[model samples]
Target: MSKQRTTQPITTGTSVIGLVYDGGVMIAADTLLSYGSMAKSFNTPRLYNIEDRILLGASGEYSDLQEIVAKVKALALQETTNSMESIYVDRKLPAKSLWNYLRAVMYQKRSKMNPYWNDVVVAGWDDQADKPFLGTVDKLGTTLQENLVATGFGGYLAMPLLREKWRSDLSEGEARALLEDAMKVLFYRDCRASARIQLAKCTSDGCIVSEPYELDHSNGWNAPSMIRAAGDLDGDGGW
Candidate 1:
């Protein structure tokens, strides 16, 4: 017999992807919120920018994501207040430090058997090291520090494509193009995904999250007639 469930996620988001390139890190996610299998909302932004230095992309229960972000923002604000009292402390938190904090929070929740139900990618540039940073933390507080990371179906569908083409020396344009291609594949296959996506980057200057933009998949691959013809052929077994 199946065990009874007390609660389940209602609104959800799919697939958040991130990678480090030559000078910094980039992350992207589709603007879609799903209720069960239905696409409940569009134009939802999953990427969050913190203090113009860090980029956060999350995929999972929407409410859970909001809760985590709100808590983090509060923590950052508190840290900022404390920074004014200390001449040595930086005004903002470091990316790795923030990531670690999230890991701790997620773990605490997991220990209580009430996890956040989200997988989050954190990206930023290190001023001291003069380099880019990329990492991820999940609902169970599992932390992964990697040049590339993703959540949800993106792990299965987009990761292979990212791994095959990613290079440490990739320029910003190249990295964006690669991410767009991977997102296109996801939009084609992941029913819960959307063609509208937002891209964010962390560089020496700062982090910037773009407005939601439509993904271009106009390669005749998803033409309505083509899909209809393929379905008809499959139904008739002409081959």
Candidate 2:
């Protein structure tokens, strides 16, 4: 006789951004996992290197993301004949393939009326044409786009900035600078976004991750500064 184990659902927090460049793609996300509206933890890496070429950015419920990650890991293991070496070398498990698989998983979950409530951005080089590709997949298994994408609170604030500066022919440096600026904007505007950010670039060569960097808000106006600058520090302009 065996005892059945019961599992409690896990929830996580995140925000993500992705943009395409001339050579490949760039994606970024903050590392703050929240419990409700409050920041509960930090340094949670939402970006993942699923295969040699693909990168994934997950946002929303942490438990759902973990389950998806686990599913991908298991599928990779099974498809590789249980050989680690084979899995690494095989090109069959490319990013696009993984994207389709994920979409299916999400769609099935939605059909069952128990969706994961998470969104993901998949960025990588198109294996067949050797071109850059960026796309998003939500809980409903919908996948679309490459120019620019965002998830969570940053989506509302960051997407506008992205559209303003985005260009399909941007150089790598230009694209990176644009993204960094956008992140800065998000940090200042979006309540969920923190001053710290983690960024990654995916090219034909591979993925390059930056050390987490913090945003400085010293130049921005605070309540005291606003009051002082308004010539009403004591609430009496006559002074």
Candidate 3:
């Protein structure tokens, strides 16, 4: 008898988020790679800096994610080489162009009935146009541009927090705080999430991706003082 094939992702990274701020865009993702219900890696980054003004964040199958990253790097090289050789000075890859390219890739895979099984967020700033953009594309090829977006459990756990905290006039500092808060919420709720995260930004000046850093989790559930000062537990059975 013939067996059926599974199209769902087997090993995956959980939760990635992206947001657009006043003059830039920022994205964050955890470093946990899970194999089914098992923890695989604790230091695998899911965020990538594509160029000086473009960042890509993905949450899904790690192998598929790597393939996308490789494809993007190859495309960048091809575009750069073509720009250097062509007479036209502006025939280069822009953030939107890269985003469109990824969209096409996912769409093609979906059409073939074998999708990449990833939810990708693209954040970029166009210096010439002086505009910032944030968008996401899923394995099914669905694309959306929003003030804030998240994948996997992040969408359920952090999206509400982002929706409430996000503002059009938010400064970079304020945006960073909001992003961190959202990440903390995810870390607290997602079993596959960790306090260690990678953060990246795309601005008019350039892109900056930070090294993996652990978030401050002091005074959390692990703290020893679990009871309120007003409520005495020692003589709880007085009645």
Clashes of 1: 0
lDDT of each: 0.89, 0.78, 0.85
**Highest TM-score against the true fold, candidate:** 1
Candidate 1 stretches greater than 4 Å from native:
1-6, 220-239
Kindly list the per-residue Cα lDDT of model 3 for residues 11-54, writing each as its tens digit. Answer: 89999998888888889998888999998889988888875757
Could you give candidate 1's per-residue lDDT for residues 1-239 as a string of tens digits? 96543266789999999889988899999999999998899989999998888888899999989988898888888889999998897778888889999999999988877788889898898877889889999988999999999899999999999999999999999999999999988998899999999999999999999999998777748565445544466645354
Q: Tell me, by lDDT, which candidate is best.
A: 1
In candidate 2, which residue ranges exceed 4 Å CA deviation? 1-10, 82-90, 222-239
Among all windows of 10 consecutive residues in model 1, the one with the lowest summed lDDT is 222-231
lDDT of 2 by residue, 124-232 (tens): 8776878877888988889877678888776788898899989889998898788887877777677766767788888888776777777666665464534553555
The superposed Cα distance between candidate 3 and the true structure at residue 110, in angstroms, equals 1.1
Q: All candidates' TM-scores?
A: 0.90, 0.82, 0.89
Instruction: Report the poorest 10 consecutive residues by lDDT, candidate 2.
Output: 2-11
Pick the winner on lDDT between candidates 1 and 3.
1
Ranking by TM-score: 1, 3, 2
